[model samples]
Target: MTSSTPQTLYRKIWDQHVVTTRDDGTALLWVDRHYAHEGSFHAFDQLAASGRKVRRPDLTVGVADHYVPTRDRAKGSAEPEIREMIRLLDANTAGSGIRLFGLDDPDQGIVHVVGPEQGLTQPGLLIVCGDSHTSTHGAFGCLAFGIGASEVAHVLATQTLWQKPAKTLRITVDGSLGPGVTAKDLILAIIAEVGADGAAGHVIEYAGSAITELSMEARMTVCNMSIEAGGRAGMIAPDETTIGWLKGRPAVPQGQAWDAAVAQWQTLKTDAGAEFDREVRIDGASIAPTVTWGVSPEHAEPVTGTVPDPAQAGDPGRAAAWEAALDYMGLAAGQALSDIRIDRVFIGSCTNARIEDLRSAARVLDGRTTVIPTMIVPGSSAVKRQAEDEGLDRVFTASGAEWLESGCSMCAATNGDMVPPGERCASTTNRNFRGRQGPGSRTHLMSPAMAAAAAVTGHITDVRRLGDVR
Candidate 1:
């Protein structure tokens, strides 16, 4: 290969977006889309302090997801500070001439979820957000990642950000996933194989038969957790699958322009024999439904596996981590995960709250009732409305799970859906960090269907053993 030719899909995108090269070797990259939530207030404040407005309001959007309550959630139901933050987003977006999807907006949802569904995420775009899950948009073949508040302000003042190019890595999974396994399980297994920071300082591109064949939403689930592995971002080459997913979505290009865009997108794939600095491969069929046995996302293993003994950690640091995590989780070395009982279940989050995810969980609960409290939070109001239309909400309610409005919900306790301290919950959210769900909350990360099974049995049961998978 010639050095003149782009080495990979990521390089191709980066080369196209670089506005200028700085003396320190950083490049000012033209951001094609910018997404923000309540947390972006700090950046907007900086913009205000400097007497500047959003440079390209048309490319920016503000949201009120993290601070909005998911329960009988009216905009006024939040505490004063939270309410003010939401209000600040509204005022700031309006003052800046950018649109804000306030709590009442039917479009209001997690920034990552809304970006893709609204057709704001597209192949070859350079996207940034104040939220880390912004990488989720990379599933559409975009080079998307999170930026800090300071960088957000920089991008607000100028439609570009200064950044160094990341090294490229390819993670490929072959064959179809086994019964009851899913994109969630696949990603968990990948993390377990490569450790939490395996992809550090690199952008990972997912490929292989199983990944390419997944529905767009499933691919989003995989990419959303890229940050968990310390990836700068995660992406898949756009194909007919991507073009089809965006064809009728809101805000996408139209008519002849759409045709031209598709033609360009079709060439966005990695060229034959193009080099990547690193590569990892996994047999998809070997991946069973997996769950985190410890606090870190990489501490995951198949549901049928036993808890790791701290002595097996092979290093002082990991051994200490395992010991602490075991103590925090009320688990013992060599304990079988299936024997671990749970007090609650969470079957929603940007990672698993899409319509397909809800349906997957509901299918497992057909004519079933929960033995423990379960909460179902849709990723967006649009998803909530669609689930209701399809009677999927009824399936959740029928099984004694609470059906709630859109928000981050149990994914974080910022909205008041706290899991009681000392109690265990099988959650579908991305992170399982200490106190991530609430003070002293123990979160076991699993797929939506696995969470549903655990809800009914009050234990970490494998969904495959429950019955024929839908």
Candidate 2:
């Protein structure tokens, strides 16, 4: 008889794709979607050496995201390394007969952004990418994660991967979020509570009142940072909100097929009697506007909290880390969050570059002149076009924020949008690790609204003070 215990969406997908169960309890999983970036070249090289062609080209999609210059697409033509990588991707995808969203394609942007916008990401499928932020796809209720280069080669050749099942963790955040609090802040608070390594080896399912109330874009932001907490994968069950977002996207099923697909998706939720291996509950109201004070995502505190004093830390090693962070950030212990001024503000990244994110930032910046350099990068060409059509771009530009072309610009320094050395920036990007934005540059991560508020105030200020959140 089949087991009757309710299973998570991740478990259900895993069971559906299992080719075999080994004596050791591991299952070989069949991948439904394989995503690759320019960094995936090594994987294809390995597959070529093994005399194996990509087994399921139709299931694979390639795009140039990481290592592609966001500031100048022309740089792709001028830089030999960037040009050759793009050429290699074009040739490889062409030879393998795989679908590709090339740099010039209107649909092309960051791989993670392109996937969901094109409706390629859906419920109950297994997705893998060569980049860690693959967890972003889990917003669609899929089991997705980043794989190593070697594993990428294996997926390319066989379209199947070996894996051991992971235990499930349920993180339920209840209550209402206070004004100006965002999914970015909620996830940052979770990381702060659990620490960076807290969810290691577990697949997390985020639920509860607050999460259910969030929009698809907010849910995506929360799931996108699962990697920061060391979770194997993170997901939210497919609900009406999710279905609404998938309505007319290209890759989504249409008409009767859509109906059938939705029917299947309806079952992709936790059963009433479902039990998780572990559970954590957070009260959303207690979480404040959070910002990272150190290199790791977990090193965050409420905006009202002062810079942590290393001498007061509970652990010796943590104290040393905090000391290092303070030194690199040029911040002193006990410094007020309000007093730590920022020189730059960046509102973009795969983490928080959606249209709603832009709207939130624009609302905060309306009728205000930025006190520092501010750049707003939309997540995709589509997002840029839509924002312009709505005159959101004008709102940002009029507020003294530089509206930029779509890409992962300023999210990382690789795109020639680095903050000047020793400058401090309030960024909406993930990862504030030492030198993440650029060598000797300091990054203070926040939601787009918070980033915009900081741009006007020139420091980390409470976003609630701006105006009505609604």
**TM-score of each predicted structure versus truth:** 0.98, 0.97
Model 2 is weakest, by summed lDDT over 10 consecutive residues, at: 70-79
lDDT of 1 by residue, 168-265 (tens): 89999999888899999999999898889999999999999999889998999999999999999999999889999899787889999888989889
Q: With candidate 1 superimposed using the best TM-score fit, by how many Å does residue 384's alpha carbon deviate from the native?
A: 0.7
lDDT of 1: 0.90
Model 1 Cα RMSD, 1 decimal:
1.3
**Clash-forming residue pairs, model 1:** none
Candidate 1: regions farther than 4 A off? 1-6
Model 1 weakest lDDT span, ten residues long: 70-79
Query: Which pairs in model 2 have colliding backbones?
Result: none
Candidate 2 regions exceeding 4 Å error are 72-78
